[model samples]
Target: MTHDAHSALLHAALDAAERGWHVFPLRPGTKRPALHGEQRCPGTGPCASGHRKWEQRATTDPDRIRATWARAPFNVGIATGPSGLLVVDLDVPKDHSSSDTPDGATTFAALCERAGHAVPATYRTRTASGGEHLYFTAPPGVRLANTARTVAASVDTRAWGGYVVAAGSTTSTGPYEALCGPEAVAVPGWLLSILRPAPKVSEAPSVATMGQSRRYADVALAREAQTVAGAVHGGREAALFRAARALGRFVAWGDLSRHMVEQALQEAGEAAGLTVAECRSTLRSALNWSIAHNQRRRTA
Candidate 1:
């Protein structure tokens, strides 16, 4: 029985590879990656030169797939970016029984209906949790990144830096199985417009502005950003957190917009060589903590 399940898993990985999707092993019966993380890496084999992330090491090689799956009945993961595919994940509510909250499919359908277009027909998967994944071929020369709750409630997307569980993979809940699609269709222009980010307006330091409080906020934003930008590698995350926490009050007090503040700090953090994920996580947590604590104190 074990060998049979192992063979089945190997076939599943090969199937995803046949579709030209980069494949990796997910831990058996779980959605997480099975690859060793950087901290735990012995710096041997694939990591001899450097620690290659699962995304970097995901492969279409049948021999590698067979060798990997032969070790165990691992679940399959498709690295969406390397596969040149953008996957729209329509998820069920957190509780899995929340009738009051609409699932991702419902919200996405409403978005499409409002835009006067039907959901694009393409490769689709039915997830174990009764949700769906719509696969679309990304347009040439365009790169998108992972997003959560940006499209709509419960609707998320995976492009670069993301992966999806392949159809043949199984979880404790149920099996992930392909629903339909002769093949993945090209993404619609309407959807692309939504996924693409707005071109950034240049943010100059120390710009002229009116109003005493507004001027104070502007100066503070610039100074804090400068601090983050000058932070060394070892101190970048802490500097970003401090800057964001300091600026969050200005946002809560309505002296500055949240978007502008986030953008400024993000740019500064990145300039200091912090990873995008690190900057985003630090900024979000710091800002949230500041805003929530201040709001509560104000009410009290």
Candidate 2:
């Protein structure tokens, strides 16, 4: 990267940090983190006491930001959870096959119209793919989890356990540029109502304690996990995706616990030589699709 490019990215990190957003380094020209994973933890410096994940490693300290960005022209990422942000990601579909589906921007606009409120203007960024990101501040005392397409078709959210590429970062396609406010407005109440998950009524049954009839779910889980674990090297991610989608029906039916199924498949995916990040992304997307499409209600 040129000196100007390096300076631009460094300023981006510093700028995000200036807004009180916890910032971290993404690989140059990529969204992936530049930091080493747990498997490669050196157990020195920041991890001198213990290994801190990227989320934990994210910082708002200017000194730390400058020190880290000095080494390379790394892109900037904002840890949404620590920064108390809830960003709505409006995404465009890839390829021509899914042309019928409306883009996230359209769907979100429709949702806003139906909700009887104009889209609340907030800090907005234009993503590299020509989609928009509307940044919102989380309401105090309310902790929201990241969601995929929960708000509307093609609309996903980032909260805890999620991060967004900040403005000034560049990808092969284009740069993520800020179009609006430096301060993200508070999350609109109407939007929050849709994003929040309903309160749990009862705990899901564990694998060992499942009733005889529900045992089918456990059997299916084991079978799918096996398929994922033993998948061919080239098709491991696809296998993991298929397994997660297949078991999603069981989770949607409430015959299987989502947590249990995720853990099983995650272990299998890792065992099959997939990275933890790869497994999580695929697993989350697949399961979200399955659960949303196949929801089942328990007897009263």
Candidate 3:
């Protein structure tokens, strides 16, 4: 990309960010190439040594992290990753309606709410002439296209000022507007209200009784690490590290509960050729036995 083109892209990205759209910057070497040789990076700051500055910023001022959505003249993009969703592209008709809006935003918001957060509306500059990039949060764990379809179902592309851009395409920047702010129009509340159902809160499980469950899971994960460590010759340690990291992320995201934690560990142990079923049975018995013992003691 020429310097002028790069500069133009940067300005459009900044405009999106200002409007509460999270923007990823794309640069050379900062990301692994997609199938077609295009790469995605954060739009903020410098790209050096293939490390994106936004990654570091995310560690600190995470609010500035771009939501998983993108908009362009001819395409729209959404992110589907463990960390969060992001919009990568935007382009559609200006007159859109509730039935024709993008599904990515609704799904993204729903997932974020489940994970105890909210998704914000984000916009970007269109690659097309005098257009703007618009995006919404995507649901965690779902494929990007799925989320996009969800948004599209509820929105009427012709009624609103935009249309749902196809995924994996590029848009021109000439027609895009580079300004987004509080005054910018958002997905109306009535539409959002109808599209996304409220999340249900479940009763909390007993923590004391859950201790054994958690411990069992931890032990299983540790054992799995040991096995992965053994199998991978030169990178056994690295394999273990990766497993540990995955576990940590699961825990951080609150996806692993006492029961599920144990199951995860058991899976890990099985992967390592350990006696997973035996360990799991033993753990279950010990926990049940302990719970009975505790009840007896309390009554006495």
Q: How many residue pairs clash in each candidate?
A: 0, 0, 71
Q: How big is the positional error of residue 19 in model 2, measured in Å on the Cα after superposition?
A: 0.7
lDDT values of the candidates?
Answer: 0.82, 0.84, 0.35
All-Cα superposition RMSD per candidate: 12.4, 13.5, 18.8
Give candidate 2's total backbone clashes: 0
Which 10-residue window in model 1 sums to the lowest lDDT? Answer: 199-208
> What's model 1's lDDT at 93?
92
Off by over 4 Å in 3: 27-146, 151-182, 201-300
Candidate 3, 189-274: lDDT as tens digits:
32343233222212223343446545644664565445553543223222333344334432433334446545654565456444
Tell me model 2's lDDT, rounded to 2 decimals.
0.84
- Model 3 scores a TM of 0.27
